[model samples]
Target chain A: MRITERQFVELIRKRAPSAGGGATVAGLRHGLRQGIGDDCAVLAHTRQRDLLVTTDLFLEGIHFRREWQEPASLGHKALARGQSDIAAMGGIPRYAFLSLGLPRRTGQRWINEFLAGFLRLAAASKVVLAGGDTGSSASGFLADVVILGDVPRNQAILRSGARPGDEIWVTGTLGTAALGLAVLQTGGKLRRSHAAFQAFCYPEPRLRMGRYLRQRKLASAMIDLSDGLSIDLARLCEASGVGARIVEASLPRLAQTPLRHALHGGEDLELLFTVPPERSPELPRRLGGVPFTRIGRITLERKLWLIRDSSKIPLPILGFQHF
Target chain B: MRITERQFVELIRKRAPSAGGGATVAGLRHGLRQGIGDDCAVLAHTRQRDLLVTTDLFLEGIHFRREWQEPASLGHKALARGQSDIAAMGGIPRYAFLSLGLPRRTGQRWINEFLAGFLRLAAASKVVLAGGDTGSSASGFLADVVILGDVPRNQAILRSGARPGDEIWVTGTLGTAALGLAVLQTGGKLRRSHAAFQAFCYPEPRLRMGRYLRQRKLASAMIDLSDGLSIDLARLCEASGVGARIVEASLPRLAQTPLRHALHGGEDLELLFTVPPERSPELPRRLGGVPFTRIGRITLERKLWLIRDSSKIPLPILGFQHF
Candidate 1:
């Protein structure tokens, strides 16, 4: 019989368990502090630091076909997805926990290669693979990467901080990762050394740029472009109770690239942030020499718009959704 | 076309990206101190405390067949698996992060039921479901649960602490979950209200008992019996560089239960611990109404054995292995 989540929770609550005298640790320890419901849970942190945690799931076939991707690249992308989330929050990732569900047919050589890719990026970013679980799957592989990061206390960049008249900014090119995927899907690989090829297989998280934006107080709100600029910006507006207007000419698209790909193509892993008008000038044009561009402005209209040929056109929200 | 993990890491390391002056987080922030290789990652905690982190993976078909199992029970079991690891370390669980690789055919109704089952156990145990990742899987469902827990510094028990002459103890009954599974598998018409069924479906992690044992300094080493007594005990002995001798008759077996099931049946989330001769008197006969039994003692022989009546027999290590 199919059961509803509501009914299940209700039944459980009714049968909630209690302990005999002094058996439970109820008042003995400082347990969980925040979240049965929230985008993320919060733990009381050490002095001057706020801990940030996020988890990402990567499944074969849905995420990447194992045949087309190297085991090492799969490993790298797995950790990269979670690291990108840490970068979005302007925090430095400290530890990574990987849970891999591999099919029983997987060979030892493949397993070792996967760990190599995963651990390399971790070492580059100073992230340690702390602990993880492994299990045999009858089907394709599934991987989950949980990353723990820390930001200066109260210095976290949240998508809810965008406000009216805030200048919208983006780091790096928009469709690089998507271009890599397009090339793979179309079976039109340019070259292994090509930028698009590398971008698709091994996208770098904008860690330094996120840190710069946070430390310089250059941005009011921030999110990573994992789900494309269109949907992610819409989410930012929704979270901040505002809207946005993007200048069509300002997008940093690769030559000959479709604007739609730059707008809706996901997996870019770039930072999309909004700067309050007063802090706009303090924002650098080049952060550590990586191009940073002003792409739009936050509006109070509560509608996303694109400024094309001096005309305001409503932009469609199209981005990747795992579900 | 296969790239070794070593080669991939070396290549990535050689091409590592760089940043401009004064942009990096620098020495201002202290990062993760341990856990590149261990069952759990350790983080410096507030004063005399240390953070313990562990993750567990449960896959459809491999760990459980969803066809027969209820959604609520699946959710409860998912969190229980991770909580048991925390108990194994003598820590209190704080937050749980789940990454679910759900099939495309899964319904909202089904998803809700699963979460209901999961959250119910969380609420009872005071663990917050802080955050998680969800994605579509072409294959059957897969879930990875990561739990963050804490214990007073250096107080968390490990598998390596058993000494010769330490008395072995176990909290709760052995093979109860396996019996439940066997009943279900054989389509035996056992009453729904049976304790075996409840134990199998809603296995409780001995969090309180683990804390009690650690605080009272009774257990020299500890491990939860996720696997059967035969394999888990062997592991404990191997870790401590010692052997063990168990009186088979002392195992708390259910009436009519087969001796084989008690030795090899997995999925029991009960704590198996060791206490020195001097400290054995401090352990209680029961905690939270769960029976505590002294099953055996750590021996210097470097081999695990079981005594039945007048005969001493070598016990084969036969617990579940993930890979």
Candidate 2:
């Protein structure tokens, strides 16, 4: 049987060498705090800071189609995916390494444009392009971007920190990117100014909001909504050993997007987090021009539930999976 | 026209944002020390150590063929390429991040064997597989391995450190991996015990030897022989703004391998370094069971020369290049 992405990750995690606690070298302590299951692997870096590392693969056909994506948007999205991981963990992105494989038919202008889009985002995020490898591809173009970020020691948010009474919250609207994907797939001619198009092609990572929540100790647990709300919420619940109950009417979504899209579509790139009931009062109604909407609450049960009107039903664990 | 790998790297370097000096965040300083042209990007990690980061792409058709390579060796070689880069800079590899894209036909047993080989090497070198990303590939299997290593502060031996009158040195015999590749290409049946076959499948990174040379401060400059003697030497010369002259008779190679393979074939994973004339007497003939051979000397003129039968001729920079 073909191995799913989740299975592959689990296999590696089980086989990986355990860096128990931290290794002491030259009287310095550097150990891994989080590994395979988190948005980013957290490692002890300096005396007061922890390093955050995340790797993402953007492949042609699997992740995007070249005919539909502008080279600039492709580059921007590529870096954004990794940056979002840092944002999810409440860290500051510092360095980025990009490994690119280009087919023989690729031209210089395309590469230049791709770099332009990538560097533009890097400058905005203050991430330096440190080093990477390039090779000739026999198939389609592929890019793997590795991002390194820094967070305050012992304060970086994690997916497993949620408690039972925490309220589930999301930043910005979900399903817009998925709606944009639908538009693209249907060969619809939409301008860059279109909301769905913009969301799908140039999703912005909520770095400032993530840092704000982290600094104030507002979020007990957090994860990025890259793979839609339903599945991502399931992941957070799984890690925290809690279930979640979502109010169908309370989810923030675009008017044009279907409820199913908001619940199951992937690549939204928003932040999904939980705040303790007592600390939820400290959260602002809006932070950095993005609205925070509470749509659910963490439960003691070990299964996901969706509340529509007065009835509660099971929420399917279907986001995006490559089997 | 297609951009060569050198041109692509130069382009990125020219356009990449400079991390001037080191940035201070929360009273700690971290910054990029070297980037792009080196084997690994050197970053100032802590007060006592520097961080070395390198990324490499191993594509199915470009770097290996699935039919010819065992899955386990593919995994080992993928990690070896990045580890070799760390060794080239005289650093100790700490963590590795792998981004693997597998085709639909990839079997679970193949993956298990691959991980087995990978973890075996990691256990040997004390390298930890901290994190990685996995995805489904629409084409061939591609793996991108990122290795992070540590070196003493300001102690990384870079290619640009070579000076005129420095004696050129190399560790181990060259071109064995290339010879192995030739055997594999010809469909020749060779046992794993065969030196050439072993070299092709399981080339070891010279970590201990590199640390020895770096700690002793014997080498003026260093680079790993990844892309053959002539081209990698040319790269070192270009980086140092110096020249090199090689004595054809002094090259250490297997008697069965062709002179052309010894000179221009790649993937030896050997250390090619330069030492000052005064320090030459302190160098050992052998360390860690690997032989050290003097093959040439750095030149005042900015060109490469090969001396044969007391007659000197220009050495062509015709090592492997993908465009």
Candidate 3:
């Protein structure tokens, strides 16, 4: 059996000292506030702000197929993924560093469109392109995007902050992106206006909602749903040393989407977070035009479960696993 | 004609706003102090220290061949390359974020050896592996390392700081790395004790020397010789809006190495810096056991020339071009 990405990360974490583990340079104290297991590595920047750094690898054929998506869409997704990490940390994305490896046959026009798409979002998000390295790839194109963001000092929402009594909530409808991919896989047109197509191609990170939740101190724990609900929730619970039980009927999805898609599909780029029972009443039904759905609650036992029509069943931890 | 990496960078620079070009986040006055066209992106971290960030991509088949080097050497070089960028900036590397994409056939043993090599150098350099992302590669293995370092505010040396009449100095023997590569290409056995082999396999970044030069205010500008002498010098000159004339006789190289390897060969990873004539006397001939040689001087004319046997000739800007 192949080792999962989580296991690999654990291997690294065990081998490499934690960032905040009292690393010193010339007897001066300088260390990351948070590292590895979180969405973004948090570094103490200034007295006023903490820096959030997140790197995402967007590899060709593995992460996306060139034939299925346009170069512009690829560019957008590349930056969006990292921004979602920042959003999950309740941070504001500021600068982006992109290391790109272009294949031999790539043209100047393709690069221009890619930059156009990337810069369009950067401009909208107020993130500046800082610096990066470029190389000639032997095979397909690859891009690793590093997003730097800022959050109030010691105020970042973490996956380990969830308590057993916290209720789990999510922003936007689930599984729409997987449905879009399903259509694309079956050779359907990418209708730009369609919600499913839009969700897959031009998926937006829940930056505003995350910031609002953090500012209001409403969320106890947060993570972006880049993977499926089941796996990402598993990660959050694992980090918190707790489990979760979600209601199947409360899961939000389009009419055409199967329950499996909502439960196990990936790349939705929505915000999944937990709130204390007392804070749940103050949680908005909608924020920044995105619907918020409450479908789960953290559990004391270390097991994932789904309540379907009053019947409790184990929830399969199925999502995209790179191994 | 294929577009050169520099041209592609220029295209990006023109398309995206410069990092320091008044980028605002929520009306806050935060921006990068330096961005593209440098060894590292400089960001204002605190009143006492500035942060330096540099990302380097090491692609399989492009940067190195699997058969030519061990997985450990590959890992060492990957981290070393980014550390060299930090060294070139006269900064102390504090943290590293590695995004790795492993091919399908990669085994656990290979990964363990790679991390051993990477972590060894990281321990020596006092760099903590803060965070990273991992994925499965469809083709060749790829790794991109992002290094974060710190320097005294406004004290980090830059390629743009060179001025006319400045003496150009370099550390260690040039072209030894290329010699090692040539030996490898010719099916020669790798002798670990050989300087050339060592140079190519695990080139040491001039971190201590760079810090000494900066602390003493001896270097006006600095750059790393990752690309060959001719091209890297040209880049430094271009960034500084000046030119250079190097004496071929003064180039430091092994007795067995040809001059062409010093002039046109790449991946030496030595520090190439500019010191004013008045400050040259104060510069050490050797620092931290590495020899330093004065080979050139900044010129008023904006042209690169090689002074060989008292005759001047154009220095062909021939180095590694990844286009």
Best by DockQ: 2
RMSD of 1: 6.0
* Ten-residue stretch with the least lDDT total in model 2 chain B: B21-30
DockQ of 1: 0.39
Candidate 2 docking quality: incorrect, acceptable, medium or high:
medium
User: All models: lDDT?
Assistant: 0.77, 0.88, 0.89
The list of candidate 1 runs beyond 4 A from truth reads: A1-41, B1-39
Best-matching candidate per TM-score: 2
**Deviation from native of the Cα of residue B179 in model 2, angstroms:** 0.4
Regions more than 4 Å wrong, model 2 = A23-30, B23-30
Q: After superposition, how far is residue B236 of candidate 3 from its true place, in Å?
A: 0.4
* Residue lDDT tens for model 2, B1-323: 56789999999989996545664345123588887899999887777887888999989998889888898898899999899999999999988898999998888999898888888898789888989998889999999998888898889999999999999999998889889999888888778998788788998999988999899998989999888999999999999999999999999999988888889988899999999999999889998888999999999999999999899999988777755
Worst 10 residues of 1 chain A by lDDT: A19-28
Fnat of candidates, each listed = 0.49, 0.70, 0.65
Question: Model 3 over residues A208-280: C-alpha lDDT tens digits?
Answer: 9999999999999999998899999999999999999999999999999999999999999999999999989
lDDT of 1 by residue, A1-323 (tens): 33332233334334333211222132223322323222234454544565677888888888788766788888888988888887877888877777777676777678778888988888889876666666777788888888887777667787888989999999988888788788787777568787777777888888998888888877888888887899889878987999999999999978856888789989888889999888888877786667889999999999999999889899987787665
What overall lDDT, based on C-alpha atoms, would model 1 receive against the true structure? Answer: 0.77
Q: Please state the CAPRI-style docking class of candidate 3.
A: medium
